[model samples]
Target: MLQYFTLPVTAFQQNCSLVWCDETLLAAVIDPGGDLPAILAQAERRQLKLEQIWLTHAHIDHAGGAGELARTRALPIVGPHPGDQFWIDGLPQQSAMFGFPPAEAFTPTRWLDDGDTVQIGNETLSVRHCPGHTPGHVVFHAPQIERAFVGDVLFAGSIGRTDFPQGNHQQLIDSITQRLWPMGDGTVFIPGHGPESSFGRERKSNPYVGGT
Candidate 1:
């Protein structure tokens, strides 16, 4: 079984998840948004060396602590470009604007392009570029594991806010319809915030998707 650990961080209270294969000690961090200490502690407890830090999007809350964690583990950070490199360069400002603490930012090692695959443990996570929240948002899908780390895309009963620097309402809708919905109805989604929900559940309940 793949062990999962969650650490809620920063004023945004973003959820940083550490997913590891118990047998192989291979690990991946999803949205190392903040709380570098907590995330490192969880990794050390399991004796797992973080191989890669994956960003679902370029939002400050999701990518803020990425630099610290990657520096600590000497791991690589990978994610989509989001076309908001300026926002990435201005993370500290966004944090202060939102009453969040100062943040350190860094560019990704590789952009999360659609059809990209990241290998972990004995399987692979198919990268689906599901933008809307940001121009380069992505969802990591591990088919055999029946799991996906959906950045800030689709939440439990809601969806990502499109008022940010790179956010868009119509694009987000298109992302859900064209990029995410095809992941199969039973796929389990571990969102960047809030609780876990299945693709099936969100399809049936998420107002934005279920409504219009």
Candidate 2:
């Protein structure tokens, strides 16, 4: 069984998720954004062996603690596509501008593309390059579980802000309507900084991408 725990961290309150395969206890930390101590504490408490670090995007709040955790655990860092390389490179500036603690930039062990699959124990998650909020943004989908880590792309009642540099409002909408909507409405998604919600619910009521 694949299980996960969400830890809200950082001044931005980003959602950092610890996901593991219950059978083997092999784990990966998704979006460590900060609050490394808390995430490490919980993973230790649960006795999960941290293996890899997965990212959804390269935003400061989404990847702030990635370098620290990767170095601490000697784990591979993966995903967020190659498109966000600029954002990753600008981590220090972003941190300074946002008054965040210093953040380090590191290259991913693997830069993911659409249709790639990553594994945690026996569980396989499909990757989709869903941009707009960030050009290199991606979503992780576990088909067997009908769940996705959507990052800053689509929110419960709203959508990710396209006002940021390189943010494309139309692309964000297309990613939601074309790429995500096909996942079936029952699919539950974890956004970057808020409560969990179902695609079905969002498609029906979300003011940004819901309804015809």
Candidate 3:
């Protein structure tokens, strides 16, 4: 079975997740923004063997620690699509601008697309290229667990900001309605920040994209 724990990391309180397959004790860390020590400690406490680093996008608050973590553990980096390469390349400047710890950029072992599937141990997750938040943004959906790790796409009562470079409000709305809605209303989503919420709830109450 696939199980996960959400850990708030960095000053941004980015919700980094540690997802593992119970049967094999193998795991993957999603969006390790910073504070690598705490992340590694949690995985060790759970007795999970860290296998991969999966990113939803290359924003500073979501991907700051990926390079260091992957280099230290010799784990492969995956996802976020190819469109976020520019953001990845700007990690150093982003870190300085945000007052975050020094960050390094690294190449992903695999650049995910709309239909790619990622695996950890015996479990698999379907990847959806949900852009607008970032052109390369992707969401990891675990059908078996009815969970979607959506980064900076949709929130409990709002949607991602479309003011950044290449950000488009219409594109973000389309990603939410077209790519995310099909995942099922009952599915619980972990946003990049703040509390988790079900798609059904957001659909009925979210001011930005509700009533669809």
Tell me how many clashing residue pairs each candidate has: 2, 0, 0
Off by over 4 Å in 1: none
* Top candidate when judged by TM-score against the true structure: 3
Evaluation by lDDT, superior candidate among 1 and 2: 2
Candidate 1 local lDDT, 1-212, one digit each (tens): 66677778777778888888778998998887777878878889989978988888768888887777777778888886557577678888877777666777787788768899987686578998887788878888878778888888888998998997768899999888787778878988888888989888888888789743
The lowest-lDDT stretch of 10 consecutive residues in candidate 3 is 203-212
Each candidate's TM vs. the true structure?
0.92, 0.98, 0.99
Candidate 2 vs. true structure, TM-score: 0.98
Compared with the true structure, all predictions reach lDDT values of 0.81, 0.92, 0.96
Alpha-carbon shift of residue 125 in model 1 (angstroms): 0.2
Give candidate 3 misplaced runs (Cα > 4 Å): none
Give the higher-TM-score candidate: 2 or 3: 3
Tell me the tens digit of each residue's lDDT in model 3 across 1-212.
99999999999999999999999999999999999999999999999999999999999999999999999899999988999999999999999999999999999999999999999999999999999989999999999999999999999899998899889899999999999999999999999999999999999999998887
